[model samples]
Target: MHQYQFSLVFFTVLTQWALGSILMISLYRAATGGQELNNSKLTAIALWLICGFGSLCSLAHLGNPLQGYYALRGLGSSWMSREVIVFGGINGLTTLWLLTHLVKGKENLQQTLGLITGVCGLAAITMTGQIYYAVEHQPSWHTPLTHIGFVSTALLLGLATLALVLRQSSKEMPAGFRALLTASVVMVFAVTWQLAQITGLELNGVLVWYRVFASLMVGCGLLVMAKSLNLHSTAMVGLAVLLMVSGEIAGRMGFYGSVLGKMPW
Candidate 1:
């Protein structure tokens, strides 16, 4: 894998995680009747920091960071350009929402802004997935599965991160929330396995190690989450997040490694 690939993997995964966090946090607020404004503010700050770091990783992928503005010029035809635009929109909207929350302290307007930010974040995730799905030369990447995998990664990482952050804020987990999260993880893994079968790619390669490690880590994380719920241990939630994030990083590495572009030979 090239250095650019690594940078891209981090950029996409981190940004998606940020996006997912925002969306999940919004849902959490709504589900809990919007009582925890202070906790929500902290969560927004953490997500913004994640987005900032992801943006920096994207810059690392560039040959000349100063010319990065040129990427926005191709928005008429390039998915990459659209991805940048969408991400910018997501960041901008989120910032505006954060400011509104801080200055105005109006829950109604803040909730509205949160909804819009979540929509933009979801669009950013779609555009990120489309960047790879539009690659005609890479058969391994040009598929619906790529989009599904991207969304799944976002949800998995987003929920795990949210769980940890909320726990830190001393927020109680809503009833059935843990069960819902676990089911989502299981469903995503099942779909990913099915997609692998559909692609019919050989499972015997260096990439297989990444896949196996990711699976084991994610599985362990889910088990840990379940145990945490049973024992009511907030610390275990943090551990679960760590495991899930590491697993996702490994899975994304495999995702990049699986690319098999058309050969001139």
Candidate 2:
């Protein structure tokens, strides 16, 4: 992989993680009729900060950071340009959503902002996936499986991290939350299986396997243990989050490596 591509790996993964977190939290809030989550303000602030950090990583990925805005000039024809615009919009919306949480008597406005942010986030993430999927030179990334894998990463990373965040105050995991956790884990395997079918297992690298082990094996194992033991230890959940995040990062590295290292130049 190109040395500079690591910045992109962080950029894409972190942005998707934040988008997913915001989406999931928004959906949960909707399901519970805007029931306020414990520490929601803190969560929103953390997510907004994460978006800022991811944006910085994205700028770093551009060797000439000052020229980064020039990328927007391609908005009419480039998926990357669209991605830049959409992500920027989502970041602004996230800030507004976060601000709504800061003031009292803004639950209605907060929920509205959250839902709007979630919708824009989905579009931004799709644009991110499209950037890779449109790269015809990288067969590994050109497949629809690429889109699925990217979305799955967002869901899995977001769900796992949110579990850790919410578990901070709850004594036991809610059934609904557990079910989402299980569903996200299932998404991890489903995407992996799809990738094997799309591009044979042999083409997958050690980093890919590490991703599988970390996100699916160790991460899910911790969740299962928590359920079976009826425990909500932040330590266990936090460890799971760490493993899943690292796993996704490794997986993303494998993603770019497949294109840069194996392509016939």
Candidate 1 ranges beyond 4 A from true positions: 1-4, 104-107, 169-172, 175-180, 198-231, 260-265
Best by TM-score: 2
lDDT of 2 at 204: 52
**Candidate 1 local lDDT, 17-101, one digit each (tens):** 8777777777777787875644566667777888878878988989999999999899789999988877777778878777766
RMSD per model, one decimal: 3.3, 2.2
TM-score of candidate 2 on Cα atoms, chains taken together: 0.91
Please report, in order, the local distance difference test score of every candidate based on alpha carbons.
0.68, 0.79
Instruction: Please report the candidate that would top lDDT against the real structure.
Output: 2
Q: Over the full model, what C-alpha lDDT does candidate 1 score relative to the true structure?
A: 0.68
Clashing pairs in 2: none
